[model samples]
Target: MTVRYAANKDVQIAYEVLGDPATGVPLLLIMGLDYQMVWWPDEFCEQLVAAGFAVVRFDNRDTGLSTHFAKGDSYTGNDMVDDALAVLDAVGWSDANVFGGSLGAAIGQALALLHPERVRSLVSVMGTPVTAGTLRTLRYVRFGTVAKLARLPKAATREQEIDNLVTVYRTVASPGYPFPEDWARHVATLSHDRHPRDPGTTVRQNAASRRFTVPALSTLTRPTVVIAGADDPLVRPVAGRDTARQIPGATFVSYPGMGHNLPEELWPDIIERTRAVAR
Candidate 1:
């Protein structure tokens, strides 16, 4: 994978492209929370590529190799939305199909709402709509609890960091799907050794999400799909359903016994749904 940087004002966003850019439909994948673009899974990207899409996955600002903010620096959710647009511009695509998970989904919603001309289609996976009412519902209660509990203590060593991530995944993983503890630990170790954890950046990103509020999604006109895990402890199915309901003609799909994490088994279904919506 050739990692490239896209300039969004002073901040530089890091991204990688999969598949033949010239031969397939352009699809942008937006990752959630403070998770790096690597969390999107190379296998998943390959499957999407095989399904005929030029997949572009990026690290949002304050995460991965992207521009990291100082402790007190502040940026709103709109900035993140604009950063997504900058990635598209850097990649020479005027518009592309967008698929986002969790916070990435929120960013996609804002992008489709504010810059409708730039989104050909959208797929929001495991995300809640950006509204006060939705945020206050029971759907978010479990997620909020898990999120709070997932907060890790300062790790003085790489091993501790990996352990923390493993614990978090184990805590939030779907009860039915086997939790890949060994693989999760390996990835966590690699990520921690590579970039280390930046709690400050995560706080800033969370602030942005908390402050953002989209009053109504009725104005969004692009073709949209919301994919949810039926057993998702974080960002429950209702959140996905509500997001789909708010947008005109948006479709919602649910996977049985799935959680916030996207398992490899669901890649085919996700790719098919994306193709169907984009069509």
Candidate 2:
């Protein structure tokens, strides 16, 4: 059965513990920005669990059922790292292999750098260390700039929200695959049920990201595998290449024509390949 553990602040951290806790290695999976733990995909998690790794996947603060901090409250990576550590402690796991996608990958990198002793191994998928003048950074800034210029913040109507969601769906949905409108609506309901997003929390998280850099990449000793989709528009192949190169003994794998989204067709291969890295 899935279990819930309380953070020190009394906020219940919900997690689904999979596989045998004592077999293979403990694997912790972290999701991306504003993404619920559900985004990790049940089949993918099950594949990992079946591969003999004790798997733990949880909701990060303000995303899933985790506690939502104040909108205006400022927080740093230290605070986030603390929350992750606390979750580990509450669950009675000292340390585990870390797998993070996108922002979660960034957090995994930070955890490896900040508390290397706590990480058994690391898999950073579609993540990168901060660097100036990189195409990735420039593209993110350009998108944010355009959003601000277009007055996207003034979107208050539910119609506007739907339009926003549809636009994003069009951009990211796998080609020829049907958009899961029902699933989107279901998730929207869960999002509202959990907690209304505080604009301040997002702002604070952005601030923390801005102030963070992966200088510690050179110091990470954990066995690391950096995975990237060659066609990813948000984070290009070069970014992943650079990240893998910076870390000693890190391996980089590129999937041709694969975009940011994890297509169901690739789940079995992705899961098996990722799990192999743990061995």
Candidate 3:
């Protein structure tokens, strides 16, 4: 992946462009909270490329190789949304199809609402809208799953941290599919090597997410598709249904046996749906 940078004010957002821009439609990929772009598998990207898309994946601020923040410094959700716009400008694409996973899905919602002219379409998966706020957002979460995953012991070394993350991935992974342990480990290792695990970023990202509200989803005009893993242990399927219901003409899809983790088996279906949405 060739790394590039987009300046969102003083922040230099790190991004990478895959596939030939001249040959395929542009697809901006946003990963979940505190998760780097590396969490997006190269194989999945390659498949998207083969399907005729020039994929642009970026590390959100406070994650991966992107700029870090001080203990007290904070940014709003618009900052994160504009960070994406900066990336689009860097890639020279006026607009593109977008795919956001988990917290990314919420960001995508905000992106479409905040900059309607810059997004051709959006695909949101395993996430609740940040605009939903604290209490409303809590309704969609399964606390038992969160409690189990949160119980992992803290790690002092890189290897230990990788192990802890892999365990988290496995626990939330789809129950009916074979676990992609290798991909999970690779993502964890990259996440650790690029930046040591910091609990502060997670807290900050969560805070910014909670603070964002406006342009209620009903006012959104972009073509969108909300995907939910029917069996997700973290965010419930109803969240996806509700998100789609709020947007006029938006499509809602739910897959049984899918969880917080994106199963490779569903990639084809998602890619095709993206093609339809982007059109």
- Indicate the residue-level lDDT of 6 in model 3: 92
RMSD of each predicted structure: 2.0, 3.5, 1.1
Q: After superposition, how far is residue 199 of candidate 3 from its true place, in Å?
A: 0.8
Alpha-carbon local distance difference test for all models:
0.84, 0.68, 0.89
For candidate 3, lDDT tens digit of each residue in 128-210?
Answer: 96567799899999999989977889887778999998898888889878999888998888888888778899889988888
TM-score of each: 0.93, 0.82, 0.97
- Which portions of model 2 show Cα errors greater than 4 Å? 1-3, 6-12, 130-170, 173-189, 213-215
CA lDDT, candidate 2, residue 233: 50
Strongest candidate by TM-score: 3
Model 3 CA deviation exceeding 4 Å by range: none
Worst 10 residues of 1 by lDDT: 132-141
Per-residue alpha-carbon lDDT of model 2 for 1-279, expressed as tens digits? 465764846556667687877665789887766666766666667877777777888877765677777756666655666667777786677888889887777788888888888888888887666432344455533254235334545448665554554445345444444555676565554554555445555566656555555455788899989887776655666767877897899989887766555766776777776677777
Best by lDDT: 3
Q: Provide backbone clash counts, one per model.
A: 0, 1, 0
Can you give the lDDT of residue 167 in candidate 2? Answer: 49
lDDT of 2: 0.68
* Residue-level lDDT for 58 in candidate 1: 95
Model 1 lDDT tens row, 39-107: 777788898998889999999999888999898999988899989999999999989999998889999
Q: 1 or 3, which is superior by lDDT?
A: 3
TM-score of 2: 0.82
